[model samples]
Target: MMVDEPPASARFVVIGGGVHGLSAAWHLAKELTASGENPNVIVLEKSQIGAGASGISGGIVRNFYRSEAMTEVIAESVAIFEDDREGFGFHQVGYLAVVPEVQREDLEAIAEHQCEVGYESELASGDSNCREYLEWLWPDVNSEGVQAVLHEKRSGWADAIGTIRNLARHAREAGVRIFEGVEVIGLGYSGAEVSEVITSGGAIGCEAVIAAPGLWAPAWWQMQGLDPLVTIGEGDSAEQRPLTEYWLAREGDYLLPGVGLAGNAGRAAPVVHFDHTAPLYSDRDGELITDQPWGIYFRMGMTGGSVVGGGLPLEMGPDFELDPYGPENPKQLAGDDLSEFFTSGLAFALKRFRGASDLWDSNPNGGVLALTPDRYPVADWTAPNVYSILDAGHGFKMLAVGREAAREILGSAKSSLLAPFRLSRFGSGATHVVSKSPYPWT
Candidate 1:
């Protein structure tokens, strides 16, 4: 509900109504009510729910990661999405990662870890095996330079806005009050802890605060007098880097009616991601697109009759403004070149999309992301009583982060899963390992 005035006080105040905030609120309300405590949880949103990056997300849910910690966390999240498949609008069409020879070792290690964690997946090693596996799914798959494949049968995509709405419904039913258009202006601090949340409408005293501001995290971090820059590494080799970097991505789909782009078994096609060093050529003019490493992920559109996907993102400067933060905002949208490259890349990967370059949708679908230094998420207590769910660019798929965060907020033991994402990692030089893949978050 859109309330004009917030309560004078609440047990907990959650900022941002996206996936992380709402998920935390929903879980918190359930736990608090079950424990005979007052479920006085309030969720404050600057705009409406699902108005941030969550609304514009590609909604791909996969546990394919080079890091074991990330794989475990995302596996749990995928389970949560599967548990409420209908409610979350999740389509268990599976997830596939096709990579070059250089990533074979990392992909094998990930597959082994997934087995140890009881996550179901199949790994196809070598160029021949990879090509055969991909051919069995889609005969027209262009697996020229592919040397490895990791296919997770349980992972797939979900409807972003639908999932957010369902989460809001759950939170509301559990006695969580959600207010829209109530922007969090600042935080009132008493000594080291936050005493209250000062908003556009009024002030609300709360015991703890969970800030999940998404792309607007830099602004919120600044409001708390926290430095946005951090020192990575140690000793004389140390380097200063922004804690959060802004990135602009272009995502769109091409309408192709009567085109049953399904897998070999007549099932819906799984979400496919291709990372290759093979030079790409334009399907429209046979012109060389690039000889360098590139990656792209695509899936059957939620609305049907369309193929939705996106390519690499363009990084914005440190001074990039995030005031108007939506694809509807002109400045937030990507350029036409991205669309051209994305479509051309799609055709280069699959013969089914041979003429995809001409089927490009005029409407642009893109948004900004606030990425951490290592591209991994930071989900820890940034302040004495404030827990920030800084997801970097991995927010939508990791819905279980909120559930785990709720337990921590309710005075439970710290989660071992979330320990790797602590804010202290950077200062201690314990950042996540980088991958050979072109994608930063891979």
Candidate 2:
């Protein structure tokens, strides 16, 4: 969040305009009002809402994950997504994962895990509704020799822009003031804590602050006396071309049965949709898809899109400095980079679900922004009034609860809910690198 002009004073200041920041604002307002502590809650955005990677996210929500910490916390966010109708748009669609022969075991294992967590999921025969969902949606799904599929009824996609817009709107109604196009420059600390944030417009006094800079956070943290290994995806590469062929994913991404249609029956009985795979864009240059805000490539986005198009891969992207209230240097993406990504993705889809690749395009969607080092979100409470949720594999699925975590800093009902994920995990070396590839790991 950026403010062109500063407020004389505020009890709380939530930075960044992305989902996490917005969630913090919304939760802050709700919690504060409930406590009769009408603190001057402010949210500042340097650009328009969702300007960073939030708007472009391929909103996928699932409880089938490996990390206990992540799963537990995200479950709360999912509750927010599903429970609250006015502020978020999360409709329950079944995620029918058409299992490729090789990944059958892993998919089954994930299903069992989902059951342990109270998710109504099961393994289905190839001839069941899973197959029909595929056939219905991608009518031409090359089901030749396709294996059994796993179905989880809880997960599905959401309208990213709508979710954030709703959060901002509701936060406003709750009495939080949001200032777009305002650039936040530096942090002004008093004694040992943050006293105020300096913006291009002036200075805003605050008792607490939340720095949710997404991929730009490394630079932001650097500005605030920290260093994180941050880098942007090689937007796109030159040699690896986007090919419109088909190949079966062995131990790779999820295979959707299709939503609403036959490939998937809108039963809300299985998984909502198929997870996306990493596309091979080149033989030489290698750039990883950073786990940033924009990396939530549900299914089609990766398929019909290019791979190495001089832009960030999925939720991955380049590192940039941000003066929340100033001109942010946005990254540019383009070319065969996109074509190759789409080509590989479609090719994989063609192999997995039998002709599902045909549902996408031969080129990747260009003009999307992202932030990185997002495999898991980062959060730490340095003191009583400040905390940051920086690392997230795909933050959107957990935004609701992530905001709840932020609310703890500003005096929410249960701050203990966030204690498990505090920065102390990293300090104690309890933080570990996690990968939630639907199934079939690389």
Write down the lDDT that model 1 would get. Answer: 0.86
* TM-scores of all candidate predictions against the true structure: 0.96, 0.70
Model 2 reaches what TM-score against the true structure? 0.70
What C-alpha RMSD separates each model from the true structure?
1.6, 9.4
Model 2 gets an lDDT of: 0.54
The clash numbers for all candidates, in the given order, read 0, 73
Tens-place lDDT per residue, model 2, 25-107, is 87878877887878478887877778765765556666655455555666677778777754566756655555445445556
User: For residues 2-92, could you state the per-residue lDDT of candidate 1 as single tens digits?
Assistant: 4457899998999999999999999999999999998999999989999988988989999888878898898899888888899999999
Candidate number of the best lDDT: 1
Off by over 4 Å in 2: 1-5, 98-109, 124-148, 229-334, 337-363, 366-374, 412-417, 436-442
